[model samples]
Each structure stands twice: as structure tokens, then as C-alpha cells.
Target: MASGLFTFRGKSSARADIMLGLGVAAALILAWEAVARAGFIQPQFLPAPSRVLGALWSMTTTQGLLWHAFVSTMRVWVAFLLAAAMAIPIGIMMSSYRVVGASLEPTIDFIRYLPVPALIPLSIIWFGVGEETKIFLLWLGTFFQLVLLVADDMRRVPHEYVEIAFTLGAKPRQVLTDVALRAMGPTLVDNLRITLGWCWTYLVLAEIVAADSGLGFVIWSARRYVKTPEVMAGVVVIGLIGLVTDQLLRAWHRRMFKYL
Candidate 1:
């Protein structure tokens, strides 16, 4: 019987993991509802999940929540793509060439440490109080981090891959394109996923300083009126957005690198 039991291996289902995750989420929601309904916390301050959902629905129906969400999403993608465009190439160069790395690493590392939010005043002055300024702020928050991450990813490419390329008489540019980039594709996808999260985290900071519209603006406006439910609703929306995008990126990563 013990021998039979040892041979009774079974495949695990991802659905089981999904169900467990949902179960945990439901339990947390129930716990929160209980706390709110039991008077354990002030409703005005904490706001029940139901109240926050109602506020979210109200915003959706009357206050253009969907539009604000779309605008914020667009801003995030725009800044992320722009940062990726510049960072990927520079990062590749830094990894592939000693001279380029030496010339840029110190400055990039130094500037990266100087808090991005602190540059709000300089960004406002340089880009003006427009969409440009907001985008610049978002870009500033994400770009340097991405550059360093991408450079590190590139550096992680196996030395043997470069040696093999050289054995085949491959040029430097060809080695970069065919070897380094290709080998680092999975890591690059992962780094971008993480950096995208960083971009979302900075969204409120980027949008709050400027004019109106977006999730951040909604939260900021609600804060002035002491609308706890609305503030919670806005926070919930941002969390949901980030969660959805993170999942989508992970799915893409799995599809693209199924072997891994």
C-alpha cells in the first residue's frame, strides 16, 4: 500500500491556485465587511468595501471614472514606451562597451538617487504646466530605473554567447542584436513589467501636481471634500488597473517564453 501510494503522483492544476487566490480575496473582503459593519472602525474614516464600491459606481456613472482611468493609462503607456525606447539602446551600449559604460554610469547612478519628485519644480519650469510637464515627471520617475535594469539584464547575457558569436565572425552590432538582445529578451520583459509598476506608483505624484483629470486628480479632489469613500474608490481603481496590467504582462511573458 505504501509502494502504491508512492507511485500515485498527480498533476497540479493552475485552476487550484486561482481558486485559492480567490478564496483568500473573498475572506479578506468578508473580514473587511464585518469590521466595517461591526463598528470596529468608523465608517467615515475607513469606509466599508460596499460603500467604496458604491462610490466607484457613482463616479463611473456621473464623474467620468472610465475616462479618467483611460487618460491615466494612456499617460502611463506613453511615458513607459518613451523611457523604454531611450533606455534599451543606452543600456545595451553601456553593457557592450566599456567606454560608454564608464562615461555614463556615474552620472546616471547619481541622478537616479536624487528623488524624482524633487524635480517637480524644475520639470514644471522646463516643460510648463501642461501635459508635457506631467509626462516628463512620469518619465523622470521611470526612465533611470529602467536604464539600470535593462543594462543589468544585458550584462547578464552569457559570456559564452558572445564567444560563440565571435567564433562565427559576427560583428559587434550583430552580436548585440542577435546574441545580447535575443538572450536577454525574457529578462527585459520582466524588467519592463516591474518598471511599469513603478510608473503606476508615480502616477498620483505626477498628476497631483498639475491641473485636473485622472485617478490622482479624483483622489486629490475627493480629499479636499473629505470624501473617504471616493478616495478609497480612487485608490481601489489604481490598484485594480495595476493588477490587471501586471497579469496581462505576465501572461505575455509566459506565452513568449514557454520554455522558461
Candidate 2:
């Protein structure tokens, strides 16, 4: 059963899916370039893909945009790690104990509904306009939702597994660490991947407050001068980073949980 979860027999179909996705992406870019060149869309508003690529090259070569992208990536990693470290343990406790779950779930759900953008002013006041503010905002954006996701995953662990552990004379701690966490590890990683994507979504918001560097700052700076191509370039960089990281996480998941 475990092997079945990871080992698909349809290798050809998987390859076809990849090909289809690439074909669609290429078609869209070609269409976009054609529309821009035909003057249907003004370059100021929506630059051609080639123009955007040129802008990206100029930024990387002359404006140190690569450094800015690196800084943004680092900030995302720091925030994601911090949130995961706290959420994973708390989520486990919430799932294991009725009292804990009941006491915290309502509060977590309430906080999750509070928009991260609405807290921007307060975060600045509390942490100042520095890396702390950005990191805090990113954490705030993902932590509450992730805690709930982790808890839900934990609750889905099979009761039969736990019963078998108990029948084998396993202690509570053993059952939790040796059995439950082991079983839930794959799902937890999957949840982390989802939450990491959310972290990327919040990256621009995090860096926009007082940031002088990063892709968000680049976009804002371009906006001031109406450098639409540069702005698009920055956005494209962010999207590419998110896509690459998401794919890496998926690969890691497949590698680690071959039985999933």
C-alpha cells in the first residue's frame, strides 16, 4: 500500500503532463509578444516578453537586482523556518490533547481571519522598519494558518496505528514520537510546502514597508518612474523564485516519502 502511494505506473502520462504545461506556457508568451508588437497593448502598460527579458538583463547587470533577489530569498527562508519551528510542535500538542485543541483552535482561527496587511502599521510600530518588521510580517502571514493545517494533518493519523502501538506496550511519548510523528512526517512536509508558498505571497508585503532592497523595492522604485518593463521584470523574478522553490519542495517530498 505504501509503495503504491509513491510509485505510479504511468511514467508516459507524467511526461505528457510536463510537455503540455510547457506548450501552454510557450503559447501564452508568444501570444503576449504578438499582442504587444501589434500595438494592441501599449508597452508602457504591458511590455513585450522580449522587452521584459531585456529589462531583467539590464537590472541584473547594472542595478544589482540579482543581489536584491538573493536578499528576498534569504528573508523568505528565515521567516518560513521560524514559523515551521513553532507551528509543528504546537500543532502536535493541539491534536494530541482535547483541552489544548479546544482552548487554542478558536483563537487561532480568529487570528487567521485578521488580514496581515491590516497589521502592517502595527508591525512597523512594534518592530520598526527593519528586517525584523519584514520577518515578523511574513511569519504573521503564515503561522496561524499553518498551525491549523498541521493540526488537521496530525488529527488524520490512523487510530488503529496508535492502538497497535499501545498494544505493543509503547508509552505515550514513544507512541507520539516513534509512531505518530513518523506517520505524519510526509503530510507535515506537504503542509510546509503549501505554507511556504504563502510565505512567498507575503514577501512583497513584508519588504514594502521600509525595505530599501529586494524585488519589492525594485518594483516600487520602477513604479515611481513608470518603468513598466523593469516593474514587470521584478515581478517575473519573484514568480520564478516561487516556482523554483515550490518545485524543489515537491521533489524533496517525493524523494523523502517514496512510500507516500
Candidate 3:
């Protein structure tokens, strides 16, 4: 009975994924047909998905939309990678030392709970209005979260892995390289993916104050002129870009670690 239930979950998960894909495809087709037929929504507002695609086509021809998309992608990529780079090292160090981890927990926890959006005012104040400010703002929102998450990942690794390594005469550095990092694999991927999504969200916030170009800034500019379709188009572009990035990351993970 236990075996049957466990096997059921694998089959269930596959079915669930298929259902989700089909459901999304169906809904999009319905929306596309409905909006195109209604014709009540002005082209400037709520352009049908087909119309949006047309706009996207023209955008590609002229390179305007692609340029903005690259700007947003650059911001998201640089900030997220920086956060991951800094967070992983710091997290490993903190987790390696019990006293350091204990002493730092309160501060890390406090910053993690603080409203990330609220930091924008101070980010601008400290960094001034420029790309650095935007990158720093995006970094702030994702950094602490990754820190706590990675530290937790390290802490949750089985003690037996380290014990066995030590009994086999492995040094501290060797155990960390072969054991601790390997143990953090799944958790690190999960956390990093989640953080990337948050960084995209934080990009919008970053643009509110300092960006001259990006999908977020484009959305705001379109909305200010009441070009809702363009606003929606910018939103669609961001969603697609994020989806592409996430799929690439998933593929990389699969290629690098078949066990996952």
C-alpha cells in the first residue's frame, strides 16, 4: 500500500504538469478570440493578443522593444548573479561557524523581515540616481533572503555526512567542498529560482525612481500616456523574458546535476 501511494505521486505530478500546460493554452486561446471579436477595447487599450503580437513584430523590426527588454534583462541578470555570488560565500562562512551563525541570526532575521520596498528611499539617498542605485536596490531585496536561505540549507545538511568525512580523515575544507556544497544543491536551486522571480519584481520598484530605460520604465511611460495596450505589451514581454530565463536555468540545472 505504501509503495502504491508513493508511485501514484510520480504519475500524479506528470498529470498535473500536463493539465497546467493545457489549461493555460486553452485560456489564452479563449482570451485571444474573445478580445479580438469584442472590438470594444480600443487598440490603445487592451489590444487583442494578436494585435499585441503584431506590435511585437513591428517592435522587432525597429529594435525599440528589444532594446528595452535587453535593458531590463541586464539589470535582472547582473543583480541576481551578484546576490547569488555574495550570498553563497557569506552563507557558507556563517554556517561553518556556530558562534558566528548564532551571533548573526538576529541581525539577518531583522533585515529579512524589514519591508524591502521601503529601502528604496534610502537606496537613492545613499547611491544617488544612476544604474548603481538601481542595481544596489535590486541587490538589497534579494541578498538577505538568499543569505538566510543558504545558511538554512547548510545547517540542514545531515551531520552524518560531515562525521563520516571526518572519520575518513577528510579535512575541514575537503568536507565543505565535497559534502556541504553537495548537500545544498536542491535547496540552493530552489532558493535561487525563487530569488530570481523576486528580483524581477524588485526591478519594477527600482525603475520607479531611477531608471531611464527598462520594461518597468516603459510600462510606466505607456500608462502615463494612457496607452494601456503598450503597458500590457510591456508586461507580456517581461513575463516571457522571465519564463525564458527560468527555463534556461532549469535546463542548466538538469544538465549539471542529473540526480535532481
Candidate 4:
């Protein structure tokens, strides 16, 4: 059992992994609770997990926490989906043709390296202090990175696969669609999963300037009032949502590519 738990680069039961992860999390939470109770830190600075939980309940019951969370989730999904839709095709084109890659890769690299927060003023100016501005910020954060990942994934497809398809009398389009795309499907899905997480990371930045209803707004509002527990609760909700989303994507990936 110890060997099973401690193996290096070896497969273990999923149940064991889940249990171990939960155990570590529980230990950390208990330690935090102890520290808070012992007055090692002021509650206002670092509230006990129990207090945070209470705050979460209160917010949910009276402060529209669930509505804010739902709004944030919707914004994230919409932006991420739009980014994926545009990036995947552009990436495929860039990888399949030298001209496309040469023309676009440099521009994408230049823009992606620019600090996203720095563009917030421009985003608001262009789209106004509305939903469009928020979505654009979220989309901008995800698209550039995802496009590069998609192009790399396409490039990493084995050359021999494309060659084999060509030798079998396949046309250029068929080779690209049937061989390259299929070969890179798993990596593309994985990249999409990673970039979706990035969209969530930008949520607070997206909503910071002009947002009335979002987890970001809730957290920012709480900070102004020094409502530490409420702020922590909002952050914890985002973390939980991201974790569940990542796990769901992993499960879908495994199921979709069982042979992998």
C-alpha cells in the first residue's frame, strides 16, 4: 500500500489519488483553523475556514453570491468558447502553410507578450463599461496563447502520418483534415483545457473596472469593506469552479481518446 501510494512515474488507483489529495487538503484546512483560533493572525486578516464557510452561506442566502458566480461562469465560458473557435482554425492554417505562419506568428507573439491589464483602458474605451468590454478582456487573455498552442500541436503531428496519407493518393486538404487534424486532436483538446483555466484567471481583471455582478465584483467589493471572510469565500468559489471544470475536461479527454 505504501509502495502504491509512493510510486514514482507509476500508475496508481484513482481512488487512492483522490483520497490522498483530499487528505492533504483537509490537513491544511485544519492547520489554518488552528492558526486562526490561536490568534496567530487576526481573523480580519485570515479568517478560519469555518468563518469563511459561514460567510459563504450568508452571502449565498442574502447577497446574491450564486447569481454573481453564475454570471462570472457564463462570461468565462462565452469568452473561452469564442477564443477556441477562432484560434483553432487560425492555428491550423498557420501550421499548414508557411506564408500563414510567417505572417501571423510574429504578430501573435508580440501582442500576447503585452500585459493584459495594460489593455484594460483600451478595452473599456473601445467597448464601453459593459459586458462587451468584460468579454473582450477575457477573450483577449485566452485567444493568443491558445492559438500558439494549437499551431504547435498541429506542427507536432508526426511527419510520417502526413507522408503516408499523401502516398496513398490523398489530396492536400484530405491529408490536412484526415491525418494532421486527427493526429493533433488530443493535444488541441488539452490546450483548450489549459487556456480555459487562463480565462478564469483573468476574470477579476476583466470585471475590475466596470462590473456589477460577478465573483470578481463580489470579491472586490468585500475588499473595500475589509470583509476578509467574504473575499476569501469568493476566491474559494472560483477555485472550486476551476477545479471541477479541469476534472471534467480531463475525464472527457480520457473518454474521447481511450486509445491514448
The C-alpha lDDT values of all candidates are: 0.90, 0.91, 0.84, 0.93
Root mean square deviation (Cα) for candidate 1: 3.5
Off by over 4 Å in 1: 1-12
lDDT of 3 by residue, 1-260 (tens): 12333564444455666667889998987887597668876667567777666667776677488889898889988999999999998888889998878888899889888886888888889889889888998888899999989998998999999999999999999999999999889778978998999999989878866788888888888789887667777888998888888889888888878875
Q: Which residues of candidate 4, in runs, are more than 4 Å off? A: 7-11
Which candidate do you rate higher for TM-score, 1 or 3? Answer: 1
Q: Per lDDT, what order, best first? A: 4, 2, 1, 3
Give a tens-digit lDDT track for model 1, residues 8-41.
Answer: 5744467765776899999999899888999978
Measured on C-alpha atoms, candidate 2 has an lDDT of 0.91
Candidates 1 and 4 compared by TM-score, better number? 4
**Candidate 1 lDDT score at position 104:** 95
The lDDT leader among the candidates is: 4
Q: For residues 100-178, write the lDDT of model 4, one tens digit per residue.
A: 9999988999999988899999998899989999899998999999999999999999999999999999999999889
Which regions of candidate 2 fall more than 4 Å away from where they truly are? 1-12
Candidate 3 accuracy as lDDT: 0.84
> lDDT tens string, model 2, 4-82?
3246763345656687789999999999999999997778998999999999999999999999999999989999999
Q: How many angstroms is residue 72 displaced in model 3 relative to the true structure, after the best TM-score fit? A: 1.2
Residue 76 alpha-carbon offset, candidate 2, angstroms: 0.9
Model 4 vs. true fold: TM: 0.97
